[model samples]
Target: MKSLPETLPDETNALQKMVLDYQSTVDQLQEKLKWYEEQFCLFQHQRFGASSEKCPDQMELFNEAESILDSLKQDDSDLEETISYQRKKPGRKPLSKHIPREVVRYELPEAERVCECGHALHEAGEDKSEQLEIIPAQIKVIEHVQVKYGCREIGIG
Candidate 1:
């Protein structure tokens, strides 16, 4: 036979080229179908999605859809293969585990005191509770110094 021309000779040659192109495309589609069939077989035997046990119904439906789409795409080579989709779980909040400090109690020692009689007195029962006591944010102190004049009189200050 003579060497094929650089381009199609006529409409018949063009149709032959189209038929060959279609056959090559079909072969490619067949390969893809084989691969997808292997993938689906793997999916059906064990885990379908990331967590098949958790959402078996949903995963089963998804796998079935994928299988059907694969079959359909094999015939219609132009259509794209179906991709798997998954939903992400919401983030969990961390719990606080801190413990609080307990309150403590104690009594103060008796304060020293001097009377007008110029003698020290021992503890009388206990200091009576003062009513209407208000606690400020901070403690305060007041100092008093008295000047005394003496002419050998009773000790007074």
Candidate 2:
């Protein structure tokens, strides 16, 4: 039998280089996979988890136009005195006039109308209030009929 060479052959060197290249490629792919996994975790938290970051102030965005209008309306005379106005108390707004209304009246009985002193009580000023009500939508169908007349003298009707 022939004895093996003390140094590696050219083919063995090429195979070793290919093995090193494959290992490096695998390592790069593993690093990429780890990065993608971390990104996915962050995305899931943003989509489902309660956010800890403070929201951007939206009132300033909405008030920007109002402030611009007020600036445009400013005058030299008005700037001398800082005009101040009282702010009204906030409460429920009045109902729209377009909505239909139903009125109901309540009257006292004839016997109860009389006062304890024997004089009859007369009607006075009344208090009024409004309430909102919701009614579900309704569906219905309508039928149409047509009538036809024929003339005896005419060939077509």
Candidate 3:
């Protein structure tokens, strides 16, 4: 069998130069990838991580929550003592009747009071809602009254 010829000196040098150039390109790409990874980590930390600026009342609220949770850690027997036969749904208290009230009434237009069936509508009912308003030195209640109209002929309201 014939033996292979050795590479010439200039060919060897050219091959070495190509290898060095490829190595430098790979090194630069790897450096860029590492920088991108660091930036991604930093962005994630800034976006989804816990906030650093905290309200002064936050620590107190945390301690209060911890204390309430600790108090709830009771014996099983105590749980039975805390139960009632029926549970009442929580609701807001009715505003005080002693407050001075200012009523603002709203009604439909005269044209709108007529039903589509050519029948005149009558005052069926009124809905009332109260809002509390405070001035510089006085507090008063503003009650809203919206009158509802109903058609009697075809019962379309």
Candidate 4:
């Protein structure tokens, strides 16, 4: 039989091996947990956060248009001669007549319609405004059924 001191060394070596194996397993599990956490966070952000990414090309185009407008304004101001140009007047665009409209007539109260002079105010032209409303798209599943016809006949020959 081996002495106690010799056996002690072998037992110590076995214990050290077990400890190393456990430590390695723990490290691998921790690494996998960290990766799963990162993936979860990314998925959550994609689902709940803003969907649009800013386009660099669009930004560049907008900046270029603004610069062109600024340069035109500067040139107009620097010219000593009076430049008479007809500028398009900005006004409310007329709503398409084809679109169905829900006419809401807002009339003043009967008492308020009469002036202090006791003369009834005549109806002037009404002002009209249009607003575009949108309905969100809906998803639906349609089930299709097909009919099959089968012919059964006995052999005559």
TM-score of 4: 0.34
Candidate 4 lDDT for residue 32: 100
Clashes of 3: 0
Off by over 4 Å in 3: 1-91
Q: Model 4's lDDT to the true fold?
A: 0.62
Q: All models: lDDT?
A: 0.54, 0.62, 0.84, 0.62
**TM-score of every candidate relative to the true structure:** 0.24, 0.30, 0.43, 0.34
Query: What digit string (tens of lDDT, one per residue) describes model 4 on residues 48-147?
Result: 9656655646667878999999999998887787569988899977655665455445666666655444555555445555564444563222222222
For 73-146, candidate 1 gives per-residue lDDT tens digits of: 78899767676986777964422223222223233333434444546443333322212222476332222222
Q: Tens digit of lDDT per residue, candidate 2, span 1-157?
A: 2324544356978768867877899999999999999999999999997675455675576699888777777744355665598789998787666666665546666677555555665655354556656566632222222222223333223
The TM-score ranking, best first, is: 3, 4, 2, 1
Best by TM-score: 3
lDDT of 3 by residue, 18-106 (tens): 67877899999999999999999999989997677577577788799888777777543366564557887897777899999999999
Model 2 clash pairs?
none
